[model samples]
Target: MDWVRQNLGHLTRGQIFSIPTMTMIEEYVRRDNQFIAGPDQKYVCSSDDLAEFNIPQGISISTYDRSNVIKLYEHTVFRHALSYQSDSPRPDRLASVAEHKGKIVGIAGASEDSELMWQVGVDVLPEYQGLGIGKAIVGTLTKRIINEGIVPYYSTEVSNLQSRQLAISLGYKPAWIQLYAR
Candidate 1:
C-alpha cells in the first residue's frame, strides 16, 4: 500500500493507467510467473453529451425484453453484446437490436452496474461490420438509459480500436482504466 501511495498517488488518473506506468507497477509487484491483465478502458457519456446516429437503410432497431435477450445467450458470436449470468450483481436489463431483412444482425445490451450507472456492450454480425448498425443500436439504447435517469457507460479492451471508436463516436469520454491480476 505504501509503495502504491508513493509511486502512483501523485499521478493523474489517466497517467496512472498508461502502459509504462502499468508495466512499472507489474514489475514491482508481480510474483513468480504470475500474469497481469488489463488496461481496459472505461467510458461514460452524460445525457447532454450523447450523440445521435441514423439507422441504416435496410436495418430496423428495436428494444428487447430480458426473455428475448436470453434466447440469444447460446450464440457465441454475440457473446460480447449479451450474457446471462444468474449470480452476477450487475444484471443485464435492456437490449436494443438491429435487424436486417428480418434477421437479427446487431445488438446493444446494457447491464445495470449500479443504481445510477449502466454499462453497455455491442456486437454486429461480421457481414454487417462496416455498416452503421453498431452505432445506431448503441445510440438508441444509450438515450433510453439516460431517459430513465441513469448514466450509460462502456468499456473495451485497449487494443480494440473499432469498439473504442464506436464509443467515442457516440460522445462517450474516457472515465477510467483498470489493470488487474489474472
Candidate 2:
C-alpha cells in the first residue's frame, strides 16, 4: 500500500488520468449527429406535411429562447430521459421550439449521430395544456429524425406513464431500461 499512499497526494492534485467519461459523451454526441444528418432516407414531418394539419394561431416553431430556456429544458426533459443531463459545458446542439404569443409552449433537441436521439419537451405553461400542441411537436420532431435515416429514440422513467404513452403514440417502442453503475 506504500505506492498507493505515495500516489494519493499526486492523484488528489487533479493529475491527468485517462478515462472515458469525457470521450464517451463526446463520441455519443458525434454518433448522434452523424446519424441525424445522414441521408433523408426515412420520413420525418415536413413543412408541407405540417401545413395539412391545422397548426393553431399564435404558435410558432423555432430554436430561440428569450429567458432561462436552457435550464428549463434540462429540468423538463430530464424527468424521463435518463441520459438527459444538466452537466456543465453542454454541447451546442438542440432542436427548435413551438412558441405561442412570445411564450414557449414546447421544446425539442436532437443530438447528431448515426441514429439521432431526440427529446421533445412539451410545456403547456399550465394554461395551454392538453391542446394537442405536445403531440404535434413531438410528431413533427420524430418524423424529422426518421427521415434522416437514423432511428429516433426517446427516454422516459418507468413511472412516467403519460410520457411513455406519448412516445408510443409517436410509434416509439421501448428500447431498454438503463441501469446506472453507482
lDDT of each: 0.86, 0.47
* TM per prediction: 0.83, 0.50
Per-residue lDDT for 97-136 in model 1, tens only? 8998888899899988899998999999998998889999
What TM-score does candidate 2 reach?
A: 0.50
* Per-residue alpha-carbon lDDT of candidate 2 for residues 40-138, written as tens digits (9 for 90 to 100): 112223333333233466777754322333554544533321224445233213454668877666665554433344334434445665666665666
Number of colliding residue pairs in each model:
0, 13
lDDT of 2 at 154: 58
Where does model 2 exceed 4 Å of error? 1-58, 63-92, 112-124
